[model samples]
Target: MNLLSDSRCGSEEEVRCLLVLPDINILSHSGVSHTVFWLLGIPGLEDQHMWISIPFFISYVIALLGNSLIIFVILTKQSLHGPMYLFLCMLAGADIVLSTSTVPQMLAVFWVHVAEISLDRCITQLFFNYSTFISESGILLVMAFDRYIAICYPLRYSSILTNSLIGKIGVAIFLRSYGTIIPIILLLKRLTFCKSNILTNATCKYIVLAPVSCDDIRINIWYGFFVLMSTVVLDIVLILHAVFRIPSQDVRHKALNTCGSHVYVIILFYGPGIFTTHTQRFEHHIAPHIHILLSNVCVPIPISEAIKTQALLS
Candidate 1:
């Protein structure tokens, strides 16, 4: 714990505070400080600008354009109107929201000399990000179920997954995503942040953010793990089931082709999440940047392209 005081107040007794930098010894289950910031020294990270800024900028632009085009095409073209396309539209909308919430702020963090964010804005970012992420996951799950119905019970697929039913699922996804995160945010709201406020990553990530406040992050961690496992992991299982249950060989092959890209997207979407799971216990400067970049920008373009190609072929 490093202690520093305000000396410019022109007082004999200065107001003192403790500054604890994040620990570098990233053991499998090491505990972090109540308020930790960087694994490496901040000054050390500040010097490595190119690794932080350039790739992130390029990736962000790519994601924005790809998602935007998908949304536009889905809206304008009547020929693409179907359950699958509806889900794709929802997916594109979620991707756009997800990218917009984090990318610009991240770019500022890496490129700008005087990048600063208020506490409120950071929380807002986290809220939007988590909401979008959850929604995307839910949409993917619904899509898997859609494919299952379409292949397994082709005669009843239309009746089973009607427009009203799909709309309900969409609402359910939004509710589930946003609702689960409310409790975590409420828990964090009780904690107090009295130390360093510089966010190393471009986005407001809850895993890394929770450690900054002076409170026990056990609840936040447990809740996050539960939600992620249930939503993401379980959804993947459902997707796998859908993939394997196709009756016809041709349908099976086509199903694989259709879902393969989404599976890749799902992996890319959740890859950074592994790092986030450890964020409460360890604070690596490069870790957050890498995770944020991957989650926010790197994965969206390829996924969008896959969606477009599949839509055209179908």
Candidate 2:
């Protein structure tokens, strides 16, 4: 009975959908959503559509090489086994996970034109993508706290930010991020996707999937906002507090220098997140390839900096 239902669900899904495969016209939900149109108005770069995929492919290559070097540097260097480098290693891991979750599938569609995505695969991609994204958020928050104690409370830094303490915090961040995902997944599970299974992008984003549902998704949207807000608010508070406690004029600059790279990272990370969260309409501005490339491929900056920091420490 279950197998029969599953098979029937696959075939009957699209006809039942109102939004994703709306009754308006045949071209309504067929090809990629017209995210490309908005890119045409970008000043002098309007004619660079073909070059968009070129940069995306180049970025994929950089992320692969840079993240691999991060892993290698952390593993091979003996003197780099401190709390800071440990967090760097974890950050590198998150970058690799994030890139792996997004890049190959994107390249497949760009190169081979394979656009169909099954429901199960869509959910799987969402799981990996969100998991890495949240984990990175949580880790960045903890990293901020780590820097806080190191610079502001230097006298007790060793005792306060001990090896065991770092381990416990790492585990807590992972749990907080990974555990928060359960409710979102459960929400998705309950949704009846009565639309085209063929996703427009290379992979599924929960927001993208929500429009296809015959069921009301207010709860899912609110919960997602709650999760995003908590991560952003908490991280910002920690970062601000860390900034406030700088010791002296000379060291203030040094302290800010230490966190500058991460500050850039948080801005880049959360900018798209805000875009994705509030305005689904803005998502149509960039080519899907450009969006994935900027968000996932730009991850190498953190990875490279983490490796360099670890090497200097060693």
TM-score for each model: 0.76, 0.74
Model 1: per-residue Cα lDDT over 1-314, one tens digit each: 22111222122222121122222222222333333332211222445654766775676677778778877887899977788889988987887787778767665555553344566777787888887877887887777677667767789988998889989998899999888878877877776754345444546668657766566777887888888887777777778777877778888887776666666767776766665455524655554445544444543344545555565566
Model 1 poorest 10 in a row by lDDT: 9-18
lDDT by residue for model 2 over 62-149, one digit each (tens)? 7677767877887899877777777877877887888777667665554543444556676777887887878887777667666656
Sliding window of 10 residues with minimal summed lDDT for model 2: 34-43
Each model's lDDT comes to 0.64, 0.61
- Which residue pairs in model 2 clash with each other? none
* Best lDDT among the predictions, by candidate number: 1
Error of 1 at 91 (Å): 0.9
Question: Which residue pairs show backbone clashes in model 1?
Answer: none
Models, CA RMSD each: 7.6, 8.6
